[model samples]
Target: MFRSMLVAVDGSDIGQKALEQGLAVARAMEIPVHVVHVIQTAAYPALALSDLPPPDIAQQALLDALYREAEEILAGAERTAAAAGVPVTTHKQLGHPGAEIIALARKVGAGLIVVGSHGKGKLGRLFLGSTSSYVVDHATSTVMVVRCEPGAS
Candidate 1:
């Protein structure tokens, strides 16, 4: 019933679990999986508000590091999916994680969107909004939120 699946990974253990689960579904359904690692560029602007504004060099350095991390995460996802014998595509994006993920799902016309739950608890979610929760709330496609295992960081 699904054409394709979109999996969002953040290099976290829960994110890896989501990837595994998404790949399992993709394999069973015989559909390609689109893996995405989004660099939350929006957060960087907040650094500008510091008493001593971040120099352009510093900002670029942070962005470069984020891009490198994204590359590694997406490459690892590709390798994992390949080993699992599932067709996969990887995307590196810069934006709010939730928005980028949902956008990619829509762009690919994916029937399912898989994301890992931060499992930060109510207070944590209240203070720092959860990306998975945001996607669940906003995405038009089916969403699977893989919860992080207790005591498993």
Candidate 2:
């Protein structure tokens, strides 16, 4: 029943499970899979210092590194999907991971959005935040959360 499936991957074990599930669903439905990795920008406080170069320069450098990492993550996802004989496209975005994934799902007209649950307990999530929680809460499209327990393949 899905026209397209969007998989949000981050190179984690849980993310790998999500990719596998997304690919499986896409393959069964004979639909295309869109793999997306978001480069979350580090939050830095604005500093007013005329003597030194702008902080944006450093931020840009960090972003470049993150972009490279994202590309690597996407490449691995592509390979997995390819090995599974699933049609796949990859995208790299810069912003909040949950928001970007939702936006891309909308843009790509994805019938399903597949994501991995980190399995962080409630207190941990309360302090560290959770992307899957955000996506589940904010996304309009159907979402499937694949939960991979620690030490389980």
Candidate 3:
């Protein structure tokens, strides 16, 4: 008894797999699929510079690049959903990815949220932080975490 499915994608192989799986479920349930890509932005300590450009300018440039990348990722996901004959809507958000995904799921009234895990071990997750873990823990809706195998789609 799901109304809508939301898939959070970040252009990774695992993310694509999650999208595919989410689409399949949505199709079977005859529900709409909404795909979201989040561009994570964080404040960085100012770099010590001798007569260099302003840090704000550098940060803005980096943010621009991230937005462009987010568009490309969303476009690819849109194409995949279209090819599967599944009508889909997409959203691009700027914030912590896990938080943004959960926010969108709630905003869209999604019955399920599908995301991909990078399969990083405990040590790796400790260093890199885990978006899937955050989503699984914080999301109000049901979450499906797709684990990506090495060299497999």
Best of the two (1, 2) by TM-score? 1
Candidate no. 2 TM-score: 0.88
Per-residue lDDT of 36 in model 3? 98
In angstroms, how far off is 84's CA in candidate 3? 0.3
Number of the top lDDT candidate: 1
Number of the candidate with higher TM-score, 2 or 3: 2
With candidate 1 superimposed using the best TM-score fit, by how many Å does residue 124's alpha carbon deviate from the native?
A: 1.2
lDDT of 1 by residue, 111-151 (tens): 99999996888798898888998999999999999998787
Worst 10 residues of 2 by lDDT: 42-51
Candidate 3, residues 1-153, lDDT tens digits: the string is 889989999998899999999999999999999999987753223332324476587767876787799899999999999999999999998777899999999999998999999888689779888899999999889999999988564
Model 1 local distance difference test score: 0.90
Candidate achieving the largest TM-score: 1
Where model 2 places Cα greater than 4 Å from the true spot, the runs are 42-56, 150-153
Clashes within 3 Å, all models in order:
0, 0, 0
